[model samples]
Target: MFHAIPYILSLIAAICAALPVLLLEPSRTQSAGEIRLVHLLVTWNPAITAILLALGLVLAARSFFRLENRAARAALLIPVAVLGLGTYAARVNVFEKMFAPLPDPGFVAAHQADFLSPHDLVLGVSLGDESKAYPVGIVAYHHIVNDRLSDEPFVVTY
Candidate 1:
């Protein structure tokens, strides 16, 4: 019961948001239409709630002014801004967790998109002029089999 409070609150909010579309919107009051509205409402309700909450909290916190008005305002503004940004950024983290199966920006940004296999070899040479030999399979796996970081045009093993 205690741990379920947040989940319960979220469910309630989702239902409340869908209620208008499911009930008041006469066209969408049908079964399939209601289902679509419920899906949209549930998906979007949490985000809306979070944004409103962050804005409200920031406003409330910033309203607590004091003697050094300018300094106090600046201090309040800085934290509120950070908090608001962080609240929104947390959603990005959530999305990463949800859809990590696909290659996301973070994976490409890290430059670890190339997954190497034992059978693969690398047959590489010097960067510009000086020549050198490398394992063909290993380098091929690194370049051909693995996904590009969305920037590099090409990578040749030999």
Candidate 2:
């Protein structure tokens, strides 16, 4: 039982860390009750994950000294490795890193009919005498556009 405790705790921590990110989309569209539950999970999972990882590390360190077989020791190391990696991933915000926001994107001028399909969506902004259009297709991928209009800096995001 003691030998398995670290693995169990590490697994639980990893799953908890991953759950909020995985459920983000569904949570947004869920009923109020479900959304509240997911909101609580997303808000608290990080701290919970950290605590679980710390406890798992302690247990793994304690168990390491008691293990006799080489293979058993090697197997015991797996959960510790996973806990370390998971902690790093959680700290780094791996999902956001994977789809990092665009930085200072540029724009091109072209006839609307040349590039845009008639049915496509776009975001339009007007500031004083300046007007700009951002195709939804482009902004959907990068999630942000930085630009200046009327000498004022602003960002557009979807």
Q: After superposition, how far is residue 29 of candidate 2 from its true place, in Å?
A: 5.0
The Cα error of candidate 2 at residue 115, in Å, is 7.3
Model 1, TM vs. native: 0.27
Span of 10 residues, lowest total lDDT, candidate 1: 101-110
- The segments of candidate 1 whose C-alpha lies over 4 angstroms from its true place after superposition are 1-68, 94-118, 121-158
Which runs of model 2 end up more than 4 angstroms from their true locations?
A: 25-29, 92-100, 108-122, 146-158
In order, how many clashes per candidate? 14, 0
- How far in Å is the alpha carbon of 86 misplaced in model 1? 2.1
lDDT at 37, model 1: 68
lDDT (Cα atoms) of all candidates against the true structure: 0.44, 0.76
